[model samples]
Target: MLKEFREFISRGNVIDLAVGIIIGAAFTGIVNSLVNDVLMPPLGFIMGGIDFSSYFINLSGGDYASLKAAQDAGATTINYGLFVNAVIKFFIVSVSVFILVKQVNRLHRREQAKPSAPPAQEVLLREIRDLLRDGAPPRVIPAADSRTV
Candidate 1:
C-alpha cells in the first residue's frame, strides 16, 4: 500500500497537477491585485468616484456609512458591489488563463511543424541496395548532361 501510494505521488500527472495548483494560487493573488489596485481606481473615478465596494442595499432600515459599517452594526445587507468586484476578478483570471493556454498551444504547434532528420545509415543502405540491384555504381549527376562515349 505504501509503495502504491508512492507510485501514485511520483506519477507525472500528479506532479504536474501539484505545480499547476501552486501556480494557480499565485496567479489568483496577481489577478486580485490587478483588479483591486490597478483597474478599480480608474474605473471608479470614471464612474464619478462611486466606490463599488460600498455599493449595497440595506435590508435592515438603519443608515450605514459603508458596507463594512453596516456589517459591523449587525445589519443584513445585499452587498452587490463585492459581487461585481468578484465577477470582474473572474473575467480577468479567465482571460489570462485563455491567453496562457493559447500561447502554449502555439508553441506546441511550432514544435510539431519542424522537420525531423532522416536516418543517415538507412538512406546509405537503401542507396547501396538500389545500386546492387540495378548493376550500376552510384555516380553523381553533373549540372549539365554529358554524353558518355
Candidate 2:
C-alpha cells in the first residue's frame, strides 16, 4: 500500500497539481489585496468616501455607522458591500484565467495548423494521383517480389 501511495505521489500530474494549488492560493491573496486595498479606496474616494464594505443592511434593528461597528455589536447583517468586493474579485480572477486559457488554446491551434511532411507512402500515392489527373497512362505499382498487376 505504501509503495502504491509513493508511486501516486511521484507522478508528474500530482506535482503539477500541487504547484498549481500553491500558485492559485497566492493569486487569490493578490486578487483580494488588489480589490480591497487598491480598487475600493479610489472608488470610495470617488463616491464621497463611502466605502463599499460599509454598505450593509443591519437586520438587528440597530443603526450602526459602519459594517464593522454593527458586526462588533453582534448584529445580524446582510453584508452586501463585502459581497460586491467578492464579486469584483471573482470577475478579475475569472477574466485572467479565461485570457490565459484562450492564449494556451491559440498556441495549440497554431501548432495544429502547421503542416508537417507527409509520410513516404502518402507522397508516393499523391504522385500517382497527380500523374493520373494529368491524363498519364495508368501504371501498376510493383510489389515487393517485383510483380505488377
lDDT, candidates in the order shown: 0.93, 0.94
Clashing pairs in 1: none
Top of the candidates by lDDT: 2
In order of listing, the candidates' clash counts read 0, 0
TM-score top scorer: 2
The 10 consecutive residues of candidate 1 with the worst lDDT sum are 140-149
TM-score of 1: 0.76
Model 1, 19-138: lDDT tens digits are: 999999999999989999999999999999977889999999999999999999999999999999999999998888899999999999999999888699988999899888998976
The list of candidate 2 runs beyond 4 A from truth reads 127-149
Following a full C-alpha superposition, what root-mean-square deviation does model 1 have from the true structure?
Answer: 9.4
> Over the full model, what C-alpha lDDT does candidate 1 score relative to the true structure?
0.93
